[model samples]
Target chain A: MKNKLLFSLITFTTLFIMSCKQDLNDLSNETNNASNVKLVGLGIMEISYDMKTIRDYETDFSILSELDLSSVNPSEEKQHVEMVLLESGQLNLTITELNFDKKINIPHEILPDDSPKIMKTEIIGNTANFYDINGKLLGSENIPIPNHRETVDKIKEIGNKFSAEDINKTIATMQGYQFIDNLEEFIRNAPANGVQVLEQGENYVSLRMSFNKIDPRIQGASVLLIDKSINKMVGTRIYDAQDNLVQSVFFGYNKGDVQSLSAIRIEQQTHLPSGSEVKMISISQIENLKFNLNIK
Target chain B: MKNTIFKLVSFFVLFLFAQNILAQRNVAWVHGLDGDAGSWQHYNAIFDAERNINSLRTSYNTDNGITHASNQVKNSMDTFYGSNANNPLNLGIGHSMGGLMIRDVDRLTPSTNKRFGGYVTVTSPNYGAPIANSLMDGSVQNAAANACNKLNDGPLSEIFSLPYGITANLTTNVLCNKFISNDLVQDMIGTPITNYDLRVGSPTIEALKNHTNNSNIPRISIWAQESSPVHWRMFSSSEFNNDQTLVNYVNDAREIYNVFFMLNTSLAMACGVGGFWFPPCWAASALYTYRATQWYKGRSWIDDSENIWNSLIKTTRSEQQTYWAYIWIPCSYPPSLVEEKNPNPNCGQWEWREFTRWVSVNYPSDGLLPKYTQELQNIPTGNRYYVPGANHLEVRNMSNSTLNGQPNDVTKARFNEIFNRPQGDWFRTN
Candidate 1:
């Protein structure tokens, strides 16, 4: 009992000293208790396992970035599971080498004829932002086009990796790489240091990109890095057979309240000039989402 | 019968409890230079003389002899300091040189800070060995002491004196020469750093020297002596009447304890700091220093050299008797001095109560110097005292030299004095 009391006193003194030495009390950005408390889920899809504790510290540092080491062990016997959170008012999905393997069940129906259907509905208050399709914002401001240095590099590199053989008779006739230069022009580089920009607000952006034709080989890989803390598309990288990030995308966000809320949606279309007809193929959406809000 | 069974079970439980408490402590022993660690048999004899304290793993940090026997002592200490500090022996018993080694190890390495639970020293000159200078100049026979402090010419002298004689001749010459000639010694030891020099950087020694004698670690110094000069001390002294042998080691301890007692007596500041409290003088520091200089002077060197290197370094080290200048010496002078004292039997020369701070027996007064002579008659500080039948070496290590000398059915009283076997009656003297 005596020892415990003395220990408590000592611990108190140590804690007091530490607090006196540091200045870390940020009160500027406060959130409601419920808003700050993050929620983790796979949206509507329920995973078989829910591990409360993980071995992320044992995570492979082999990669410079912190990759979740939660049983990502390549061993066949152990089930590989990636845990993610679906926060309130938000549903985000990220996949891995497993990206192409699994598809999200789309709730929306598709048209039987594979004809181009253009939908132009601005995101009302803010056009949100046009990302490089890999999910990264093109720029801080939603311009008519993405900041293009990355788009050009990615498009060109992806073009070079395609083999004539992979470019089947079906895809050869399609207009795919024809607009590659135009896509390249969309990826603009970070502004020069001394250049002054008077505005730092959302600029409605519009993007029109489609793979009118794809090589038959189906060999390409890409990854997107999202900055969840600030709700921004930090970067996106694309690699071909050469295994280089031949393409990249960058973007940023600003702090605002729920009143200035936002959202993002993605769509993918792969067009191949298959037989005589454009193959009036009907393909359902590989992903979907649902949200119901009752604001007080 | 049922009660007896209950008692037995209770007894076993108590034994287990005792083991647990004891095991919680990590222990190690240290020794001063010149004393043979190889002489546990001798240590037994000394323990018997002073009252036995079985604690082992003694250390002796300084001295050419330690350097000579570094490999051996290091191995012994490694076995003792423990592979891990977590589990320790709990009790450490060191003699003259072994005691210094313990202090040094504690000073240099993390042997034990708050960890050590207890300490037992049998006649340790924690300040230093008198014959250090002589030992440096090819005089003292303790090879281990010389080897431990390969270079004792100058800064090393601060620890204590360098006593010289025939025994130190060949070894000192060879070791000193080898040390000086070596490029490594010149480079590595360009400067000699003393314990005082270390007091600034190292906290334990600083605490040992500064704070309460000891706060968390409980410690006891069992000072004992044999005034009768050993065969080697007699032959080593150039001044026929001025020699102190291994037996006089008690007096050196007397000085160290005096300081500790003084600082402890000062009161207020020094309490519960290091672990152990100074026995009598609660306020000894305001009153005295924690790790007192103890003795004012150690033995001197008698130069007998014609060669330059021999004359400069070797001769000066051998001939100087540094002990005379010590503050405690003159004040605690002879006949009139003992009477001038507080008359407390426990009071040593420094007015610090002697009670086990230092103790000596059977002075060889006739042929020895006055300091040694006085030590023989110095009232034993510890009320409890024990003696075994043997000479210096034999008394130091209780082991029998010849088969006849070995373990001759020591009386329970004698065994108690020697081992201080906690559970047994061994600690009867304490």
Candidate 2:
């Protein structure tokens, strides 16, 4: 009787422990309830602004005349206006500073050499005025420079905080950022400073370009560096059996910097949005050139 | 009473013989890079205890590439079972580089009437790892110090001075130079060899690309994928990827055509986020919110390209064009780091803790392999099976082990199906 009772007790203890262990395991799985949750689909949108070239404005600045003037403060001595014009045209502008009011008709003419002449605007005291090359007044406007002293102080503080090296680093990073963010737009609109036929293969034309970087509206002023120093250009362009341009790729490197060559294999695939018709060439690298592909 | 006892003993002996016959599908286990024969002991124990099946372990210093290890696997198998064994051995199971070894053996060995069973590869880097880049140059120092501690013999300087010596062999063995050579095994101890290149057309990479597994042999790929614990790192691109709900139109507008998702179903726990809350959110706030800030943005062009490629490129391939009928088994949990072994026991404990903390801060890896690299896409036969709360090591280690209180042995049922399925019905869905 003693032996039987001892055996029974052992069995009961084992059963109890096993049950407890099972319960604990179930509880743990319950706590980590990732599989139970429904996947929430998310939508992401990207915004990028590309400034028009002088050629763009000269082609048609009629789009500039469509600017909304409702927000302009008539009482303010100086005001700032920023516009992205698709096309340009002539328009009347009036500037009133204290008692003096200046008015002039402005013709939106853009330069072909991709110069900063398109970004020019002048304002003085109560009467702000702009003129053509013939010394004739074209336009005048009254605008308020809000918290002008504070703006000046802020600019001075920034200058103090960032050294020349720091500014250059910031610019370099921004340039890389712009190249990645607006790659297609940059390639389409960018004025190729210099494009030369580097190599002419049997069916392909390799074109090298001295690519120029653009200057956008910095705060309220368009800051364009007028330095015409050239950088070496290198790139490749592939052609098909019919001599049609299949793909083109290029990059500009600063002097003394290491030159790197990259290539992407273009496989035939369907169009993205429509999913109909095969695309002969696909461009995968729009961001950084430093990359690798794992095959097999 | 004596007669009854004798009868029972006879029955038990007969039962053992019968079991041996039934469990004819013996397993030949292969370990990953830098692993020893004892590495798969825990797994072997599981096979013995649960299935009553005996398995042979491949005893090779796993420093050599998969091609070299294939010869070791064949010798080990042949030695364990004589040239003409009455009972046939069929199944092969591998972990990481071990998976490649098995594939190479199967490919090189001519097919016969007595062909083996299919293969199961756990967390194998069939495609190269991006983490390999971190191993190049002096960049290895930038990786987690805890991981570095595992590579060093004594002081860290010893490994640095003589990179290709004992220390380099140990760590270089783990790097799997065939898959990647960019950075991982950066400085070899004493050799003039600075660059280990695994670029296309390189010997090992080219060989790997050329080799393809047979269609008859089925392949089961088990890999881990875990959500990053560094979600609350306020302004980083990682944080932005983690918490899509946190919206700032100004910042959101800049994020183009990308949506990142965590592998596991459970939201990262509040306690996990608590680690970043130190100094009441010093690094966390900056990492999460700051990257989204225009001036401080950190961008990965590779990730950007992946997004565009996934959307634009059609991912369809023919069966004949691909190898490995891969069934991807997903492991959802924090991955395990190195097995604790140090001169000082306390050092091992410290390494584990620090490594765990490091993984929680960085990308969600299988402790050793990243989830992105672990995932294999575009195989026609590829299917997914989800296993939550199981890390890289736990899947192959002892069954009794647990990660975050969830039992690692949950995969036993799947293993049973793979191992004990009726002959020639291994590929059947049921």
Question: Evaluated with DockQ, which candidate comes out highest?
Answer: 2
Worst 10 residues of 2 chain A by lDDT: A50-59
Off by over 4 Å in 1: A1-296, B1-31, B35-37, B41-89, B105-115, B133-216, B227-392, B401-415, B418-430
Give the top-scoring candidate (TM-score).
Answer: 2
**What value does the lDDT take at residue B212 in candidate 2?**
44
lDDT of 1 by residue, A165-277 (tens): 43332122211233232212321210221111222223211111111111122233333232222222222333344553233222221123211111111111111111111
| Model 2, span A198-264: residue lDDT tens | 3332322222222111111111110111101211112223333344433322222222332221111
Q: Residue B395: error of model 1 in Å?
A: 3.6
Interface RMSD of each: 45.1, 32.5
The lDDT of model 2 is 0.31
Question: Candidate 2: where is the Cα deviation over 4 Å?
Answer: A1-296, B1-23, B84-89, B113-115, B133-210, B229-367, B370-386, B398-405, B408-413, B420-424, B427-430
lDDT value, residue B263 of candidate 1: 20
